[model samples]
Target: MKTFLFRSMIGIFFGAFLAVAITNCAVYFGGQELLDGETFLKNSLGSIFCGWFFTVSPLYFELKNLRLSQQTALHFMTVTILYFSLSFWIGWIPLHLKSILFFSGMFLTTYAIIWLSFYFYFKNIAKKLNQDLENI
Candidate 1:
């Protein structure tokens, strides 16, 4: 519980940092206007929750009974649902069908790239470990 709380705190801060950075970039490069106080607060809270979820979600992989594929699928689905819901609520994603579809594609592509990167990274580590063990 303590560890979980600690991670959650870290996640919240990290999320806030990301939200600020992204907002700054958008305002600077995209000519987007700064959000008003109430809207900004709402978006920030949503981002923090997203950060918390992303941070703690890896804990799901620790479940012994579930295969890695199952864990990945569950995590992906959970993230998708949470992100879409929050995105819509925060007005980051417009309610139009075309906007939804476009964002969904972008989200899935980004998720796949991240997932593959981690998958290969850990697989390389495991391979190295196995090779080291064989040399012992």
Candidate 2:
């Protein structure tokens, strides 16, 4: 129970961090377009929610005995790619994919960034926990 709670909290923190990362990236790259407060807020919140959803697969993999790296990566890619397509197609935020292949490429790139960010965030926490356990 405790391990589950701890890992879940770490996952949630990673989700939040991923959100910030996306928001910061947008601000850096799309400053002019996001000048409006409403657009900025929408993008910020959207990134956070999507980050949370993406983080779930990793957390599940951690909880389960998922050993196949290739399978895990493929599964994550499939889910995230579909999420991007659905979000764009539903008029949720107007992704403007332009092309199916192009959208998939962009989705994979974004997923890689978020996944790496979450990986480091969770690793730091796990290291801290392990050190504390060793001390005790």
Would you estimate the TM-scores of all the predictions? 0.88, 0.45
Instruction: Quote the lDDT for 24 in model 2.
Output: 78
Q: What residue pairs are clashing in model 1?
A: none
Local distance difference test values of all predictions, in order = 0.89, 0.65
lDDT of 1 at 71: 90
**77-105, model 1: which lDDT tens digit per residue?**
88999889989988989999999999999
Put down candidate 2 lDDT per residue, 1-136, tens digits, no spaces. Answer: 6665665566567757776776677678867444667755665556555555554545555545556475467668767675765467444535554565676678679867977886789899999999999999
Candidate 1 similarity to native, TM-score:
0.88
| Candidate 2 segments whose C-alpha is farther than 4 A from its true place | 1-34, 63-74, 85-97, 108-136
Write down the worst ten-residue block by lDDT for model 2.
Answer: 89-98
Model 1 misplaced stretches (Cα beyond 4 Å): 23-35
